[model samples]
Structure formats: C-alpha cells, structure tokens
Target: MSVLAAIAITTGILSGVWGWVAVSLGLLSWAGFLGCTSYFASPKDGLKGLGLSIATNLSGVFWAMVIIHLSTWVGIDIVGYVVTAVVAFFMCIQAKHNILNYIPGTFIGSCATFAAAGDWQLVVPSLLLGGVFGFAMKASGVWLQETLNKPDTELCEEN
Candidate 1:
C-alpha cells in the first residue's frame, strides 16, 4: 500500500515534469490523502479504504468530463474510466481475497465515465488489461501455493 502511494507520487511528479502539471498535482494530492487515511488500516480495511478512495476520485473524473464536454475534448471522458477499470481489474486479480469487495467502486467509476463519454472504446482495452492481470495473478498464486506446500522436512534441513 505504501509502495502504491509512492508509485502514484512518482508518476505524478514525472507527469508534472513532462508538462501535465495540474493533472499530476491533483492526482498526487489525492493519493497522499488516501495514503494517510489508510496508514493504520488492516489489509481487509485497506481494500475497503481503497474502494472508498477511488469512489471519491471518481468525482474528479466527473468534473473533468464536464469540463471536457464543454470544451474540445468531447470524447475523452472514458479515458479515466478505462484507466481505472483496468487498474481495478488487475488489483482484484492480484488480491482475490477481497476483490469483489471493490465492485461498488468499479461500478460507480465505470458508470460515471461511461455516462460522461458515451463511448464503448473503453471496454475492449479494459477487458484486455483485466485478462492480463488475471493471468499474472494465477501464476503468482500457483507459485505461492506450491511454496507453501513444501514438506516440513525440506524446510527444516540442517543449516
């Protein structure tokens, strides 16, 4: 979780340095806020907190979509939704223990962005990313399971 926060911050700083200053700053700020709130939460609670945090972030997407709709970027609203969906799907695959717990946030984000952009372009890419994430999780889970199933004797070999 802390690593996620660090990644977000790093990405934001990189984006800012690359000229998307306002957007980067906003994202970084939101990540910081959520990271602080999640600092003391348990793993289960942390997943729930992430959902809540994403729900809040969706508000920004809503407003950004409104602004985009009023301006020249008329069909860009779905971009944010697609990005979030892809991330969420991967997150669920990686952490299936409480994956379904975030459905509410995913639904809310997808609905909001879809409504704003009215485009289907987001679906295919999101699904592709989801599949990739699922595969990765499957591989990792198998590895972990095998490791855990090792015989006690193998683990207790003379040092």
Candidate 2:
C-alpha cells in the first residue's frame, strides 16, 4: 500500500507538472482516498480490490456523465446531488449481493468522474491506471504476507 501510494503521489506530481491538473487530482483521489476504501473492503485480496475499484471507477464516470447531461435540462445543483444519491443507493443494493459488492468502486468512480468533469478521455484512462496500480499494490501485500508464512486467521482478525 505504501509503495502504491508513493507511485500515485509521484504520478500526480508529474501529471501536474505536465499541466494535467484534473488528471493529477483524480489520481491523488484514487491513490489516497479510494485506495484506502479498497484496502478496508477487501483487505489482503488484491484481485477483488482491483475488480471492485475498476467497477466503481467506471460506474462513477457513467453517473457523472448522466448527471451532467441532466443538469443541462434541470437544476444543476439539484440534479447533481440527486443523481449522486441515486447512484449510491443502487450501489449499496449491489453491495448487498455477496458476489456483486462494488459500492466502494462506484463512489471512487463518481469522485474521479466529477473531478475530471465527466471527460471520457481523461476519466477513463486515469481510472484504469489507478485501478491497475491499486491492484498491484494489494497483490504485492498479499504476496508479502504469504511469503512470511503469516497465518490467514491472524490477518483476518487484524482487519
């Protein structure tokens, strides 16, 4: 997780230097905030975290786009908040299904999408990169735990 965060921070700084401020912010959000969410949700399982992260990020982008479009025809502020709530509700429902728990990802995705102003070109790639890096970090953590021959029961209890 530390290594993943370091990479994310470095990437954000580099992105800002390159004048991609929106992308930088999105990456920072993913690395710092969303990553924590994934960690807490899945613990030592990187693959599950990766899947959830990707799904949530993409869901956010989709919802952002929808809200943006709807705002043009309605009250922007109202639409924004309402749409967010709706997405959250649906995501929670999905989370209730054991194999389909992806609410966290949706939250991250929505944040990233809004940060990037629903720009597909920007949001899509950034989310993908963040998701992949996050996954790799979690996987590495899992590997380290296994290499140390740590008991799974102990790890679960710590979480």
Candidate 3:
C-alpha cells in the first residue's frame, strides 16, 4: 500500500509537470502521457524499462506509418483494411523478439501516432521524452517511499 501511495503521488506531480512542459513547448501532453503509461507496462524497470518502452513503442510508430503509406498507396477501401490488418499481425507477432516483447507499448505508440495524424516528428520526441519522465516518476516515487520509511506488515499476538 505504501508503494502504491508513492507511485500515486509521483504520478500526480509528474503528470502536472509533464502537462506544463507540453503546454510550454506546444507539445501534446496526452501523447506523452500515453508513453509514460506504457512505461509501467514495460518488461523491466530502470534503464531497461526506458529502453524497451522507447524501442517497442517506436516500432509501433513505424508500423503505423507503414499502414498509412501502404494503404494510401493502394487507393482502395478493402486494400486499406487489409493493410491495417496485416500490419497489426506483424505488430503482435513482434513479441517473439526478447527486446520487443511489450505489446501494449506498441499499441500505445501506434495510437499516439494516429492521434497525432501520423506526425512522428512531434510524437517521436514527445514519446522519447516520455520515457525519461516515466523513469523519473518511478525513481522519485521509490525514493520517496524509502525516505518516508514504513513497515510492510505487522504481526499480532493472540491473548
């Protein structure tokens, strides 16, 4: 419960900071938040979580781009649907790779890109920065929890 509290506090503060930075820089806070949420879903935490979130998430961006281009190029409704389906298959199957195993991150990345109307330029940097924010959020939370100090459980004596 203490750990959960730590995470909640960190999430609230960082979310505010992230929104501020986004508004200041005219970036999409929601998009960056999407990436941040993806971090918790990552296979590991610390540097590994950061790296995996970025990698798997970017692959999603790439596949989404492929879906957009190929579908547009084909110039048919059915073809577009097929292209999306095919790309989706690839996206899911990519979990076969050890490093690219976080499927939700990929989905989140793709959704972010699509929400941005495929502006990877804007989304890329935002998502990348999001990974950093996510790392900081967790690190600070864990640190705060440790600093505050707490017992995980207590034993009771029977009278």
Q: TM-score for model 2? A: 0.58
**Model 1 ranges off by over 4 Å:** 1-116, 152-159
**Clash counts for the predictions, in order:** 0, 5, 0
Report how far residue 38 has shifted in candidate 3, in Å. Answer: 0.3
**Tens digit per residue, CA lDDT, model 1, 1-159:** 244454454444433343343244332322332222322231333335544434433433443344444444445667756655555455345334343344433334344344436332343223222222223333344455555667888878833
Location of the lowest summed lDDT over 10 successive residues in candidate 1? 33-42
Candidate 3 Cα RMSD after full superposition onto the native fold (Å): 5.7
Candidate 2 Cα misplacement greater than 4 A, ranges: 1-44, 75-81, 96-99, 141-159
What are the clashing pairs of model 3? Answer: none
lDDT per residue as tens, model 2, 21-140: 335555443433354444346533656666666666566677667767776668768786787677667756766754447666666667766776666666676567655555555455
| Number of the top lDDT candidate | 3
- Measured over all alpha carbons after superposition, the RMSD of each candidate to the real structure, in angstroms, is 13.3, 8.6, 5.7
TM-score of 3: 0.90
Tens-place lDDT digits, model 3, residues 60-118: 89998998899889899999999999999999999999788999889888988899999
